[model samples]
Target chain A: MNDTLMTDESRLRREHHKGHYDRETVYRILDENPFCHLAFVQQGQPVVIPTMQWRVGDMVYWHGSSKSRIAHGSDSAKVCLTASRIDGLVLARSAFEHTVNFESVVVIGEAQRFEDTAQKTALLESFFDHLFPGRWDALRAMTASELKATAVMGLPLHSASAKIRRGPPNEPEEDRATPVWGGVLPIAMQFGKPLPDEFNQMPEPGYLARLRTKP
Target chain B: MNDTLMTDESRLRREHHKGHYDRETVYRILDENPFCHLAFVQQGQPVVIPTMQWRVGDMVYWHGSSKSRIAHGSDSAKVCLTASRIDGLVLARSAFEHTVNFESVVVIGEAQRFEDTAQKTALLESFFDHLFPGRWDALRAMTASELKATAVMGLPLHSASAKIRRGPPNEPEEDRATPVWGGVLPIAMQFGKPLPDEFNQMPEPGYLARLRTKP
Candidate 1:
């Protein structure tokens, strides 16, 4: 992997200090977040859609109904995929200095539809495995029509960047002495007790029982 | 206040039943999520920016560095703003039926720069108040250059929609009897312990000490 990735177009244009293009940082944030907002231009205007997305190595993939115009619009198009997780709320002394601690990644690439059913099935299984380990094998195999209705597009993570922020708020020397509470309030994703399906009559998989994400 | 909002441009083309155009649902989702992905066409290709944004009434606001090109790009142009909160992970009996329960809002409109100093100042304070309540007044005031360096843009929510999914996974009868565990793992965002600044010498505010999001 390259030390950094900065194309004429991928370079961070604002707050450059907070910008990072390292492949490791980019890949880590991508893998950690399963949801991403896909941005693509249509008829001179841009649209954003939150969808299920995953990354394998450097290639990113998204799935949707092939019959849907909006979801299928991503097939062979210039798109920007972005995923972000808010780490904490950075409470600076001054309102102007207040910011959020976050890790974000952006990948700009052209995505093409995967016409090969075998490849889509394999990727779909991976998606299940990633989200629900030790359970994919037990589920029934997918039907051809199910595969036909789904559209999977792959975008190589060629041009990407990650912006990460951590630690306490950046309070200037003068404001530090002020009698105001200033610090970082950590925000985390916690999984609660699982609610079984109405007809589910089987024992919980060990992995599903341990599906909680450590905040 | 009406029953539903359906615009030729803003309507959900797929999963039509999941689409909601009611102003109440749209407003509620907007107020609940402070972070939004702003999508707009930048030189033909779309760019998705993870930004701090909030909606007040029908107006949506975003903050950024005024000097930067991408941040300033929203001065006056068509844009799509989207915010989403994941409610739970739907573990389904079938791998193909897996989904995430979430609530998302999308608004399509044109964004204009808030150039007036007074208006910008008020909005900036609102940002702080929304993120950290009972703390804005304790901080020091901003200088003119600080105000000049920041960019605030407002977009009116003219055409919008909210997509919400809740409850457990949609398991059909045939898949329900299978001997595989399937359920809904509720996900939540919780605020962790506050990490004080190195120089902070004041007691934490009531809001910060008991920081929690009611999921």
Candidate 2:
């Protein structure tokens, strides 16, 4: 994708050096993070809702209850979806220079709902398979009524940008000599041992090992 | 706060049982999560940006570079601020019953900038004190230039609501008997060992211990 195609809104205004318009950087962040916060206009006011999101090729998809306001309001409307992962906290010698190491992507596009049940079901299956590998085939199949009550919306990844910050804190040369203990405290999301429900009778699936390997 | 004062826009249209308008629930979620995604209308389009936020009494505040669009665009505008923490992944016998256990708050209000340097400076100081306890005083004082380059905005918590989902997944009785391993995979954010910067010598502060105890 050409960098020029990226809109000015998607570009990072303050820290331009941290902005990335390339597909590789943008897609990597989106693929690694499954949760996203979606923003859209509702009754002339901005509203944001957190939901699970998955990406297929150049499109990003999210699902919600068919009767939910988010699904209805975002369909065919311009919206912004952001996914971020905090990697660490940078402690600087001074409070003003303190920041967090993170990777975030902002995608601005027109959201369109997948009205076709067959296509939506396929996408939903892909989502489960993508996150849990072989788990989709292990569970009971989705009923038509269940599928009918879900709304799946997709947005093209045409206007997307990634902003990333890593490594040590950026401090002034003078402050670096100060006797303050400045450094980075790494942060990560970890999955605990599988907790089986009371009614469950089967052993934990091998696909769960994938969660431990996720970035 | 009177429940009737909450506008229809702020009320949850579906699954009302999971919605909470009480101050205790809303404030607790806001206080627990420091990161938030702020949404506001910009140039007739919705924009969402992730930022670090802090809560003080009845309001939530966030700071950004003075020159950043988010700082300017959000000032005096109707915005939505959301903070969420994912506790676990709920695996059900059927795909349709899968969900996540999380605590989230959505606050809708007008954002106003704190223009006075002294007030903004004090608020910024409190933010550090709130997050790091006594570390604010150990760092170098904020310079006048740094103060002028930052913009701080606050929004009232009157129009906020918290949505919490916890415990086991809700599955059909028949599906519960399926031989599929159904349970919750607990998810948590962990802080790793701190890495000190290559600077002058100073022992790691006692405040670092507080990070490990955070929820």
The best candidate by TM-score is 2
DockQ value for model 2: 0.81
Error of 1 at A48 (Å): 1.0
Error of 2 at A32 (Å): 0.5
Quote the lDDT for B38 in model 1: 89
TM-score of chain A of each: 0.93, 0.94
The lowest-lDDT stretch of 10 consecutive residues in candidate 1 chain B is B67-76
Best by DockQ: 2
TM-score for predicted model 1 compared with the true structure: 0.95
lDDT of model 2, residue A193? 87
Residues B1-215, model 1: lDDT tens digits: 34555677788877887899988888888888988898877666678878878766668888888876435554248888899888888888776687889999988877788889999999988877776676778888888998998888888777888999998888677878767888888888778877887887888788775557454
Q: Per-chain TM-score of chain B, candidate 2?
A: 0.94
